[model samples]
Target: MRIRATAAAVSITGVLALSAFAVPAAQAADAASGKAAFSSASADATSGTTTTSTLDVTFSDMKVNNGKNIAVGTTNVVSVPVTYTLTHPADMDTSSDHFASGPLIYRGSSPDTASNMLISDDPATCTATSSTTMSCKGVIYVRPADGDLMNADAGTWNAGALAVDDSGDHTMQGGLGTTKVQRYSKLTANAGPEPVVKGRTITTTGKLTRANWEDNQYHGYTNQPVKLQFRKAGTSTYTTIKTVYSDSYGNVKATATAQYDGYWRLSFAGTTTTPAVNATGDFVDVQ
Candidate 1:
């Protein structure tokens, strides 16, 4: 991948400042010689070499995904937003064709040795606020279908910054910030009998599931707290009736007295590795 400043009018190729150290082999080859193509095998591997240097530039005020957990689903790409400030020498011309800069997030001890890392697919757009300071914005595209992520990759990840100058010298700074990657959650609800006698018992059941990157499927999310909520017909609000926990198979069930025509659904509060979700409401009639 190429690294470039937003204000630069020229898009330079053959320079892998942001990807030279930790990029996949295929991508590295494509960057270095522009002959190879990216494949699943290359995308699945995260091991690579490291290049470190001390430059006069510094990165600060970095934020990834707006400092929120990134929820990724199977078969879809998750594009994360990143913003930061770049401070460098007053005489340095970042807008020059030979200069490039960008941001990245990685999981592991360091960016160079990270088990997994994500770099911006596009160059960052930066606007100079002063002679030596710039405000930058960019994106990191996470493709789950490409084997870029796995179940084990969930949780916290560290952020870093990179840059390359006219002399072909590059520098990277790690431990700049952190963010979380989580699986997208799903919930389902079904209530029966459809028409019940007044004062009779109405049963509501549901299931909680989340994406499993390993199998590219959604699996049970068991033993988690879920809310059973009900909304009377003609009303726009739902009220919690009870709390239930998912079983070994991620099943949840609750019962309530049939007093009025209403809808029932399940709501999950979510965990660090999964996002909150609400099932579609199931309608029931009380006669």
Candidate 2:
């Protein structure tokens, strides 16, 4: 049988064949088990006649929970919610709960396990929104250090959806979309001339980096805006002094006149492609 992954379809009928867009092992197992009972009972059959075309299925309004930019390496367990609306043709058999649908994640160039693979928790649990349309929702986790997409496999990853009737007659898979996120960003700052005279300029320098799935290492981010902020030694609020931009190497530098004994730090507001991050405060003592 043909299973669609991304734009093209590949051949694999195993109970659980991993792919960029997969049926998932749990769902596939359920489909395999359930289909055996009704294999001879083909879909859109009329009086046991063999005149029919394949079942029709289409998807719409796909959404990912916790936002689409999947940032990893900060927390271990990342909560992900999968939601989509689909249209099922009237010809197919929808008489029972023999349906399954979920998301699939693959890393390292392909869906092969040697690179990475992730699947939904369940299949075919979507609630019916209309006679021809159904809305399905499920949750999945991205653990950089522990889950299927391991920390070692850091880099760009892909996500998709697969829906099936499990009656061996109709199936539909979502577009081969990207998570568009690498790894969580890390920021660090250091101040020179710590015990500076009352009027000396305090210089703060730092670096910004994030996960690069291509080579599997943290790389510098270039041309991004970051804020230099400070808080009094005894106070908690941090006041923004100036906005500093990261260089081609993701390096940051800022200078401020020593005023009061307080803490100095750099913050990144982040962008559509990355998540916001803040570095720990660096304390400077003024004489």
Candidate 3:
């Protein structure tokens, strides 16, 4: 069996004795225990038939670091044992079969330790106890560090957050057929709080306006962009409004041109730049 680790994925191929996919192993089938089982030869059948049989197996290149072809600069290794089983059925026919299982392809460390294994291609358990020579395929397990294919099981979102550096541009692809990205808000304890001006009073009619200085506290808040709603004293429904960009630090404000002034709340008028993944900001209210 041959396992090749690439920067993208692990590729596997080879001839085998059994024709089935590898299955995960139970505690009873630990690699150490399996290693012991493959260290002996079989005995003949007890049937009255004059035929007798025996089997012997050996393993090679049981570690990923020892793989023949590996991606350059990728420190991860692929470790999986490759075994060849020789079978003599009834002593009259002798055939050989190959079997491979375990973590299969791993990038770093041993799977028996803290490493993650391949979900599908590789199985923890592998065997060649069949009467005939069984030929099976190799399992190639791989895990990526930065970007990975999307996971459909977790709703339509990707399995992990969209990670972007100060100005890094990254493309996403792969996994479960379709591709998608999951973007999350990037608020941290050290980033400070959203600018909040308690008891903001509004007197004008159009979209509510605010002192630009109050909105400037949130570093990422863009010009007068507002996205929120409100209603007058006797109104049953609320109306939506747009935000105008702020020029002077004190001119920042979200506004609506309605002419009823019983009481109005400041609707946050937020705008985002292109490539929405990096957009995030706080809103302010206006009378």
TM-score of 2: 0.61
Output the better candidate (1/2) by lDDT. Answer: 1
lDDT of 3 by residue, 68-166 (tens): 232211122333222222222333222112222222322222212212223224422433456633323233432222122112111121110000011
TM-score on alpha carbons, each prediction? 0.80, 0.61, 0.25
Range of the 10 consecutive residues with the lowest summed lDDT in candidate 2: 42-51
Candidate lDDT scores, in order, read 0.73, 0.61, 0.25
Candidate 3 has its poorest 10 consecutive residues by lDDT at 158-167
- Candidate 2 vs. truth: CA RMSD? 8.2
Q: Per-residue error at 125 for model 3, in Å? A: 19
Give the count of colliding residue pairs in each prediction: 0, 5, 32
lDDT of 2 by residue, 1-287 (tens): 11223322221221222221223355655655554533343222111111132436665666665445778654456667767776786554443344555655555344322144556644535677667877877666665544344345444555545554554544324244556444678899997687989989999999998765444467788989999999989999999999989999999999999989999999999765567899999999999
Clashing pairs in 2: 100-123, 100-124, 101-123, 101-124, 155-213
lDDT against true structure, model 2: 0.61
Question: Candidate 1, clashing residue pairs?
Answer: none
Stronger candidate by TM-score (1 vs 3):
1
Better of 2 and 3 by lDDT: 2
Sort by lDDT, top down from the best: 1, 2, 3
